[model samples]
Target: MAVVDHAPGSGHRTAGDPGGPGPRGLGRIGAVPPRRRIDPADGLAAVTAWRTASDGSPPPRPVLATAVRWTLAELADRYPGGACEVRVPPFGVVQCIPGPRHTRGTPPNVVETDADTWLALATGRTTWADAVATGRVSASGERADLSGLLPLE
Candidate 1:
């Protein structure tokens, strides 16, 4: 089981991702939800909405927000243009670094990849230089050189 540290004042808890049922997640995959007679779709919709929403609100504690935030912060720091520059397709698009901004056509620097790959890079599971070197990620332009910052977490 993975060990997680507790917040300074909160009670200790573990939510899945550790070897047992998580408090708010789908427990054990097949075990019934704590509440009775609820449609499965509702739960799925909630999680999906939470994942896609743009409110910038953090997910509830004892949830996956730690990993998510870690991923975002890592990406934010690693990407040269900062958090406002990079752009992802479905999950997020942020910009990083300080460079001449482009308004039309392709910006001289651009990096595009799928969500999973981006998440992986953000979480330190992959490296920007390695991903680009391996041809798994596409990078273009001089200012677009992200070797200085990458693999967020």
Candidate 2:
């Protein structure tokens, strides 16, 4: 398990520590809280904010990165198996769709796309077929078709 320590005088509670500042009455002294997991809602918020921006400009790198990571991670969680490798370069990759697991070498099923294209597909701004037709996505293998699992919203 990973741990996170609050700074001194931060008044945060630590697990199993008495007399702390938080509701649990645990003090920050020598506290080793578990590391926070990435929240998918946070990532979705980032993407939504970028998509709804009035200026119609591309999202900042950090926001885009967060959105991509969240969506891909969500897919992995939902599918819960490593039969397909989904790749969005420079952002995130996850193995999903239940079938044969690839432990070595390139996976039999692979899908690759740029961050923008992925974000578009994930947010329902674009469809998988349209993206493929426009040459925005490159997919291989029998299970590479993610049309049924896209627009993760």
How many clashes (backbone N, Cα, C below 3 Å) per candidate? 15, 3
lDDT tens readout by residue for model 2, 1-153: 777799766876575457554654433455556533468679768788768752488877888888888888878878878899999999888899999999779999999999888988988899999999999999999999999998887
The window of 10 residues in a row where model 1 has the poorest summed lDDT is: 61-70
lDDT of 1 at 46: 38
Candidate 1's residue-wise lDDT over 1-153, tens digit each?
Answer: 867776744745446444434755555655555522223354334344445542477445323333333344445545545313454554445456776766556577777765556555654567888777777667677666655666432
| Model 1 misplacement above 4 A | 1-85
Model 1 misses residue 116 by how many Å?
Answer: 1.4
The CA lDDT of each predicted structure is 0.53, 0.83
RMSD of each: 17.6, 8.6
Question: What is the alpha-carbon lDDT for the whole of candidate 2?
Answer: 0.83
